[model samples]
Target: MSLLFLAAVNVSPEAMAQGANDEVVREAQPSQSVQNVLREEHALFSDRLTIEPGISYSYSDRSNLALSGFLALDAIFLGNINVDTVESHTTTFDLSTRYGITNRLEVELMIPYVYRSSQYETIGAGASTGGLVEESVSQGDLGDISAGIYYRLLPEAEVRPDVVWNFSVRAPTGKHPYDIRTNSRIVDDGEGGFENLTVPTSLPTGNGVWGVSSGLSFLKTVDPAIIFANIGYTHNIKRSFDDIGSSEEDVPGEVNLGDSIRLGFGTAFALNERFSLSMSFTHQHAFETKVTTDGGPEQTVIGSSANAASVNFGATYGLSDTTSIVTSVGIGLTDDAPDLTLDFRIPFQI
Candidate 1:
């Protein structure tokens, strides 16, 4: 959601106005013209030798209602409805460096430390058990480490948008969710007896799978406004695990998570030379997940496909020539998305 858009803001307005003087110097000497041109050129995207360090904070809230389980015998049926809600807060510190091997090629490395905390609440009602609220808190790591490269295919022109091809590889560096055990106890049954009940534990910070992504990005500048769009696809590499159980029963297998397609477009308008505002929409569609058990056939997980969308509003303010603050709020546009998200980032260019 964040990019080094302010990398070129180190140039002062006074220096920009010196273009007239630089042009005069260029006309007087050919060798100085090369230096003058380099000084005048401002890169809107990644420039050579730019290293950016940033920290970001994000918060999101979500809720869902589902039928957890049911009991039936003969012609009688009993059902339970579980209302689940969660709120998560995450903080990530990342250092990203972009180096241009050529004017049209850039390589980037990004490393991140992520901390996350989430609160979970569940309320259930049924025949044997009365409605009760169970709550728990969990916190840990979040995203994996990743590296990327951007290759510019076409440069921006008066009528043509700049095009870039993006490729990235992700490593499983965070704590992966696996070998989880459920907490269980005897609870009051509505009929005065007791029933064994179980509740879910906290989630892990990573998926434990390597991933790769490729995409195409486009950008255009129109005076006071900039337009950007991208489409990407990500594939998660299948890996074997000791245990892959949703509950107590062990289901060891090689899991293949569903691949996803991401589409996004946005526009940023410069309110002034030091500030900008943006609005964007993002959508993702995940294919059905398939899991293959040891010596068993691959099975498609039911209800594993997901569609999520969000609308985001963002603003960026310059704190200095090398530092900036960026903030964004996202509203969910679909049931699969978080109800709301808030993010704040501070980035420094070195």
Candidate 2:
């Protein structure tokens, strides 16, 4: 965390007791104030180095029910009902290094390791007894690595806020969702037929495509409070894979992932010199994804576009002049977002 000091004026007691003819000399003193601790966590210090290690965890669960068959006489309906439920948990550990190339520019690189687990359950699907089937998968691997550059477009002033522009590129170095084999079992249907139920054998650790993002952030300080906002867009490069199909046969195809737009704003209050609290809201909207199979015409994937929104609360504590601890909790506000997320980071300046 960063610290700011306010200048104070002190007058001699003797001078204050003297008459109007006596001139009192005042001395300026410095006192601690909380100002930029939240917005400027990674502020660029000329020719300085900073290393941050962080861990984050997220959990989400979704359930869906589908019915097939027609209604009889608009009264009692006859249908084949199926219920699908999935629960997922993810954890990531990452290390980030930032170097200041100049007073106005800095660069950063981050590498992460991810572990994921998911459970899938189906009820009343191809079963005469309405039995429940469940499967679980877990995987751990390296996540996508990214590098970014930050430029201070406008320095903070008494009448204006600090403005920064950043650009980043992400590499697809982790396990992707595509081309993973699935485990299947044959189940008997109530109508004397059999159906194959399948589930993934492993979870994906990355999106599999390269991505580029650009964003601008604004920060302003007002006495004991700091305000910040940011907006960004991400573009995912189109990539091809040897097998994008779900069937047993190999079907090569190209996948064009949906681009996304992100927006966030927050405010922080300094409780004291070493501690601060923050609250923020963030939202991301993703476009629809498209795919081309076997060089065929591109087809859009329905329901692939989604909006995710979350509210977050954060705290930062300065342990020393060169080190700080930052922690945050996020609660999902939309169906597309995770149910809850927690993050912890410790940054050391050298």
Candidate 3:
């Protein structure tokens, strides 16, 4: 599983400071346009006692070939020799709320629902038998619940950029993967033979362990354009599972999934009073996973590390003083990343 994090906007001291951080540099008269600029405050943070409700949808597709340890080398040359071809699709819907406790502090809460579908089929293992096996599975469940707080570290200024600090924690409120039961069946190989196979299974909605993340965000005002950068890290706490294996055979142990480092930079251009465009590049590196087997020594899982990167384009359009719509499309730049992702969000302040 993977996570996409959102970094909020910078908080300034006064109307002039906010203007300097977003729009003043582009206009000839700063005071005369204060009201027009203030109306776009949703682009950054909400005012005190304001509550904002938002929803976002995301989709990703990924595919890979599974190879046996012994035939791993041969499978490279003979692609069809691989055991199975796996394809997966994931859809996530997040309902979230944000409220401002003060001008420089904000709190947020989010709940997500996830749906996943997967398919696996034997390739050339039994080509003469019209392929050995075909399986499909689908599942949906509630995802992790998360809460966060953002604090302004530095107010916007002409010489220095606006900076904010964020901390968040996620609870394991969703169904755990280890608790899911595995299913298998015997299928025809098309060559008058039957083969026993462990069919493809749907994935869980959340990791069973608790997670905490912290990050720093900074944004610089450049008249018609605003440039922002963020860096963060997430650490998952170790958790014991009753059964970690898929088959009937059980492997109970303590699992430490991985710690990830994330970084991104983006720029948004004000197309007009009601619309804006943005582009960003993001990267995340997850360390190798570690596991301890029934009080045994800890061991690293091979090929558990991941390096993912993506380029994203976004647009924001304001419908009114307190409502806005945002949308983004992301394309993976590395093999470990999802092939493509599309997201849409609508935020309304009350």
Q: Output the number of the TM-score-best candidate.
A: 2
Clashing pairs in 3: none
Count of backbone clashes, every candidate in sequence: 0, 0, 0
Off by over 4 Å in 1: 1-82, 86-91, 125-130, 190-197, 246-250
Candidate No. with top lDDT: 2
Residue lDDT tens for model 1, 241-343:
9787867678889889889999887776666556777778888999998888888999999988989999988877767655666677888888777667776
Candidate 2, position 256, lDDT: 98
What residue runs in model 3 are displaced by over 4 Å at the alpha carbon?
1-43, 48-80, 125-132, 184-187, 190-197
On the 0 to 100 scale, the lDDT of residue 325 in model 2 is 83
Q: Scored by CA lDDT, what does every candidate get?
A: 0.64, 0.77, 0.66
Per-model TM against the reference: 0.78, 0.85, 0.80
The TM-score of candidate 3 is 0.80
